[model samples]
Target: MAQNGSAPVWWKDAVIYQIYPRSFADSNGDGIGDLPGIISHMPYLERLGVDALWISPCFQSPQGDAGYDISDYRKIDPLFGTVADYEALIKEAHDHGLRIIADMVPNHTSDQHVWFKEALASEPGSAARERYLFRDGKGKDGCEPPNNWQSVFGGIAWTQEPERKDGKPRQWYLHLFDSCQPDLNWDNPEVRTEFESVLRFWLDRGVDGFRIDVAHGLIKEKGLPPYTERATMVGEDDDKTPSNAPMWDRDGVHEIYRAWHKLLASYPGDRMLVAEAWVKPLSRLARYVRPDEMQQTFNFDYLLCRWNAAKYREIITDSLEAMHEVGAITAWVMSNHDTVRHASRLGLKDAGARPQGIDAAHEQPDEALGLRRARAVIFMTLGLPGSATLYQGEELGLPDHTKLDRKYRQDPAFFRTDGKEIGRDGCRIPLPWKADGPSLGFNETGELWLPQPEQYKNYAVAVEEKDPDSPLALYRSLLAHRKAFSLGLGALEWAPERKDVVEFCNGPVRVILNCGDKEVTLPEGEILVASHAIEKPGFLPANAAVWMTEKAE
Candidate 1:
């Protein structure tokens, strides 16, 4: 059990592993992963020692934005499986003493959704049209978009409806992401009531909670004002978001969450909600987790922090302080489906840089250095006083498929940006479960939606499971230690300042990370586990981290 020792609050100190359903496994021998594939791997997840699983969206989608463009909230996509498959997955996960957190997308729905279809067919100012953001074009002829807001993918945010048979002027609809994903107008009471029921639909089916997609974007600023600033992808900005940005992190978003929180509280099993808010300024982000709102939010600041010890220290301190103020636990993340794998990202020439995608022409990441740093960081993250979200394949030390060809790219961001941005396909490639196979054991038929890199063979779980020093082994050990010590629920204390190193104590365990090139002398304690082997006694290698307990008197 996790530190909280209560069914309702397990998330507060749990290590939740994120499973990108499309690429995790394919039990049906199809190229794409399905719910059955996930059920087949329950034992693997159970052995991983994570307290819960945060499965990415598998709801009926048009595959636009890779499942973010949800079409039907109540139905599971056939590509993944049917409703029975999802129910079985939930049951199997709970059977293994694990909790399941579904990805709920309330901000927008696919243009193919029934609501959007009805809205498109209905006349302007009708209730159907009111469900979404539809407005007359600004110019007299109504050919121009209502506002200059740009989509997060690319181009203008508004898309004009097709010409009508009656020859009436076309109206434009707002989509912060791709054109296929029309943003819902939360101002409509009907929208609120419908989404609340959507939450209940999943909660009733036995899901432990939800990881709310674009949690900060549900409510746009009133009047839908034009945003003149350059548009950037989500989770890219490090500084504070402008108060008048027009769409993101608006104060009204809290009301929606407060009601959802109440709905969740009414249910049994301590059902919870986690926000994927990419909002800035630690204090502002804290508001999402205030007493009556979400229980947790992803700590993107920690994920974006550079490799420098000082930067890591600052991010950790600020994150802990901010969450403490709200009486909520912090959730630390190193990588996810949306970002480049840390094993590759940390090894880049610029450790702080977050490229949209990597191709053959891109400068190659330093694999050895990146894997070394990744191991060290994971050790540090596990020892911290909060929940840790481990992305799939990170335990196998997987890196981005940097050489993925453009022809195979399916991310909407790629097409929307006209190939200027490579998109996230490289990171979403299927996981390698075995060392020798046509598709690295992702499926029986060897078919793959995205090609796997040649190097993936070396990182396969089958190969890692037999190697004691592998990242997989290290993760199991770290998780075991974390649970035994209740580290996630313990307090963090900074060790004496040291040059080019981050040292901290969580309960009886002390963690030391060496960011400098030179070796550091070991402290007086019994070594528990180290990211790298210590060639010489009493010395820690550069870019390595170790956990230790106090020596007996």
Candidate 2:
């Protein structure tokens, strides 16, 4: 893509498909999916057509937070296979003309990571001890954690040490995510050096690039303030409450990233950096993507929109407008592992019907057509001005599927226990890969780590792949269309999608959708992509989406 060689090894214009290793597909029937499993599916990706695959974290970890909590940066977890497996996977992907960008979580590491464990064993002044953030507190004297910071998963963000050394009381370290995920002390040059080496480790292994997680949480203020919030008002009080003070997107994080980018600059291809900046304000968000640090930061305004056409239109337009001036590349996302699936969020049908085949005929508002409609939206979004992120199973239009009752959800949000909200696990369930196989194409060991719909097996890639009209097929077509036009640019123009449709244009191409409840007339022109069955040049169903590039007329 960057010719023979270029530097940010730019994936900015790339359409990245996320692969949650544990749930993607099982090659060994070991219940858990592994690198080999992902390798096996690379051809499928090439066929479906994508420039690159952004596999989710596969590094060594306890997996309490799936692969997000890394126990070892240089090694792949045995559960997901070994370093050799990863090398093979990457090499094979490249062989197939696809790029592979691994997920890198630099802000924190699992408490079980060797560095953190060593830090716990050493005395305060020891080299190992200086590698992490630690501050003495009254927790050893039966007092609560220092400066109440809430964990993103719930409860206090800092965890108190059970074991103490010398006469000092027990100390605590901050974790913006789960307690097991201890935040790294970026103030320490050793921490920066260590993470820098981690990047080189993969770069040496020939990785295309990295999608840095919680990219802005590398630093924290020297002394965080105590938590305080009014309890009188209720409903997700956690949002207003400070189980602990916020520890993300803090001060001094830019220098840390700039330093990392500097280290990455020496590599062969232009290494790419995409930051996940969840903090508010487009101004603050802009810092992560300045040419010095990351190439792009996640576009925040576009995803939170409600399903209404006008609302969606504004978010899209505003995002493009705001970022248009910034020197950084743009990125767009409709769904990710952390949020509700787009189909469900858009109020489309999941696996709600009985096992019979889905009907293309008129149906309830939540049926499969919603997925088809979603695919069309994805095509337009990915084909727009910046880079795009694809959550695993989004290509299949997979909906949320989780069975852990209220009490067992691993999400800290549930532990925060805000009026029975179904944490994010629903969006992280195993994928269905076969038409009638047990455990879908996912895990086989005990019932999968999360629940699977009965229609799960039927939704597998192996099955739907045969049907030319399947959601997977539409995704492939979109990807192919993208590959043909992504590198070069065309101006984007807003077009009519209908009362229910969401429409737009990129140069000479036009995209139309019938995201509403009735069939619509297609604009007269050359058609590029239609989410639903197209009997003629103009007729389209209620949920159909169409893409086109008209001839001179």
Candidate 1: stretches off by over 4 Å: 1-8, 233-237, 240-243
* Candidate 2 Cα errors over 4 Å, as ranges: 1-10, 125-127, 138-142, 165-168, 227-246, 348-369, 402-421, 443-447, 496-501, 514-522, 534-541, 551-553
Poorest stretch of ten by lDDT in candidate 2: 351-360
Most TM-score-accurate candidate: 1
Tens digit of lDDT per residue, candidate 2, span 104-147?
99878999999988888877667876777776665447346776
Give the lowest summed-lDDT range of ten residues in model 1. Answer: 1-10
Q: Candidate 1, residues 343-460: lDDT per residue as tens digits?
A: 9988998885678888888988999999999999888899999888999999999999998989999998889989988889988999999999899999989999999999999999
Whole-model Cα lDDT per candidate?
Answer: 0.90, 0.69
